[model samples]
Target: MLRNSPLHPLARFLLNIISPLEGNTLSAVKNTQHFVRIIKEQHVTQQDLLVSFDVTSLFTNVPTNKALDVVKKKLSEDESLEHRTSLSLNAIMEMLNMCINTTYFQLDDEFYQQEFGVAMGPITSTQRYIHGRL
Candidate 1:
């Protein structure tokens, strides 16, 4: 829901710019079809097995505090966020924490609030996946 907000894209863009680059990762599979093309080009035979797995309910499974810690660590290591942007790294980190920590849902005359884990529809989902727990 908040993704469509006017400031969301701008925040996302800024985050993308300031965040430390992963450069290469297994998660790149989500970004392109080249993995298949490469496998085909290499003539991967029936004997050659591929082992790939995805975590189900990742949004609910990842611990938000851990994810935030990873972001905070990476932010501290990368100096650009402080010098180039008006937002403090701690402020940026808190914003991410706020985004993921305040999750909730309603189901069948019941309401539940998430005490941990990222909220649905956040751009930071990829970060949680990449960094894992602190």
Candidate 2:
């Protein structure tokens, strides 16, 4: 099971480092309530437009390379990263890439590799990074 996999701990650790940095972004919202409150507080005119998108197959369709690039940029710019963890930025990125790219699954007697996007279940940390960064 993925939960017992060696990379799972590393994914969780990286999530800890990345989550804090992610939540500090201006676009980050605590929840739907927070987002709604912010929208309500805004002063808007008729000319101002509110827009939203319906992203079909959002999780499976996320471009992995683009997500990694964004996370790399965020990690590089984080001044507090050294205090947060001893792992160098390069090391963290490498492990993250390994964890994400190395994902595969077994079905009965068959095994298959995921060619795109992180798996949709269990790996909530990876999902958060993609959702927050993108």
Candidate 3:
């Protein structure tokens, strides 16, 4: 079904324009110094605990529809910030569907479509932007 969809390219294009890298709000640690400074500022104590989250293959785990719903809510709330972005929430959501819903993979020479789950890679930050708010 998705393989024949004509809007797919348009969707991807819109997604590219609205890509999250353009507005990275994260103060991503660039080096050991930044990591050390953050850790030092935390003032770790003997009673305090350290934690690490494992999101390996996390993209395949997210339910596409539910995540999309969350993205919709986020978009609605952030509508006031629309001046920063040209695409409407509807356009972004539509592109998101076309981007993630049509994922196809090969197995022993056969191709199968992924009906659910968000695709990984460039879409990762978008996923974080939507989910991190919750």
Candidate 4:
């Protein structure tokens, strides 16, 4: 269903707009290899501590409204956004709302609409955006 949904293209478009603006935060890891390299380079002793997190219901826990606000603020503050796309921030925000807010899914031949948080598949980076903000 996602392949044919009008929002799919819009999601891609929004991703294109926001992705470049998603400047790397200090906590972000590019991939497992990079993370492993960093870990291997770290000199750990008895005083050093290592911790990990396992978030439950990760995508569903992200507040769509708050995520949108973060995206908006990021876009508005991004100096390179104009160089990336010709679309106004308002236009991008409108499409983002449509993509994030109008998600639906099917289960057991029954259609269900999400009432809160980011949808599971569409607009995957939304989770990252929310995580950085929240």
Candidate 5:
């Protein structure tokens, strides 16, 4: 799938490394949810804000290479391996890749005329819900 596709190469590499990490994905999702909730609560209570500005094209503004690099470094960190963080990393990476592919194809990008690769991580359904927009 990586050999002939428009998806970023770094995304593919991360997917390869994360394929073996088993449990990290769910934890990552939960962590993100927790983080978001905390932020929302803080905004509501501390800032007295009921509305938050969500900027679209947020991910598009993130350089794909940089995002993949951060993921790769985190996945390969000694602390992560020692604590078995790869599992969640793998699951999240796979989920993100699926989301990106789906979004890309939905945009009718001519370069994205291919099927998504295998799903190797856990929390498959939840991941889809969390990152379906990529």
Candidate 6:
């Protein structure tokens, strides 16, 4: 169904423009510099003891299903659809459908499949923007 959709390219273009602003390479460099500065200022030594923790599947825990449900409910409740012309409503519906269908899969057979729908309304992209696979 998605492959037959004509609006997919437009949806992808809009997503590229609206994805989250975090995780930029420049931001990562800046963050590293700031961290080093803080360490130097605090005189934290390796012998002072360091504790590190790692999280697995951090973004996967964001409740994408819940987010998708909320978006669908809000769209259904909007009274604007009643006043808008049929053409306008159709355009909005197309975008919503595209948003709902957007997803990516992992290549490894052992990895869990990753799927995401609308996590933020039209202005924001899904949470797994920088996934290594897709």
* Number of the top-ranking candidate, with lDDT as the measure: 4
Winner by lDDT between candidate 4 and candidate 1: 4
Rank by lDDT (best first) = 4, 2, 3, 1, 5, 6
lDDT of each: 0.59, 0.75, 0.60, 0.76, 0.47, 0.46
RMSD (CA, angstroms), candidate 1: 7.7
Candidate scoring better on lDDT of 3 and 4: 4
Which regions of candidate 1 deviate over 4 angstroms? 1-27, 30-32, 37-49, 108-110, 122-134
* Tens-digit lDDT track of model 3 for 69-120: 8667756666344665677778778877767676654444655455446655
Error of 6 at 103 (Å): 2.0
lDDT of 2 by residue, 51-118 (tens): 99876656667778898998999899989888889998889989889988877654445555566786
Report the lDDT tens digits of candidate 4 across residue range 21-63: 5545666778789899879988999998899997776877778
The worst-scoring run of ten residues by lDDT in candidate 4 lies at 125-134
Tens-place lDDT per residue, model 6, 47-107, is: 8986657755444455665744544454465555444334443455456555555543333
- Report how far residue 89 has shifted in candidate 2, in Å: 1.1
TM-score versus the correct structure, for each prediction: 0.55, 0.79, 0.56, 0.75, 0.31, 0.30
List candidate 2 stretches off by more than 4 Å: 122-134
Q: How accurate locally is residue 128 in candidate 3, as Cα lDDT from 0 to 100?
A: 38
Model 2 scores worst on lDDT over the 10 consecutive residues at 125-134
- Once model 4 is optimally superposed onto the true structure by TM-score, how far is the C-alpha of residue 52 displaced, in angstroms? 0.9
Q: What is the per-residue lDDT of model 1 for residues 1-134, given as tens digits with 9 covering 90 to 100?
A: 25665446655755664545453344445344877765666767789888878777677667777877866776777756656677777777766665555444444455445555555664354434433232
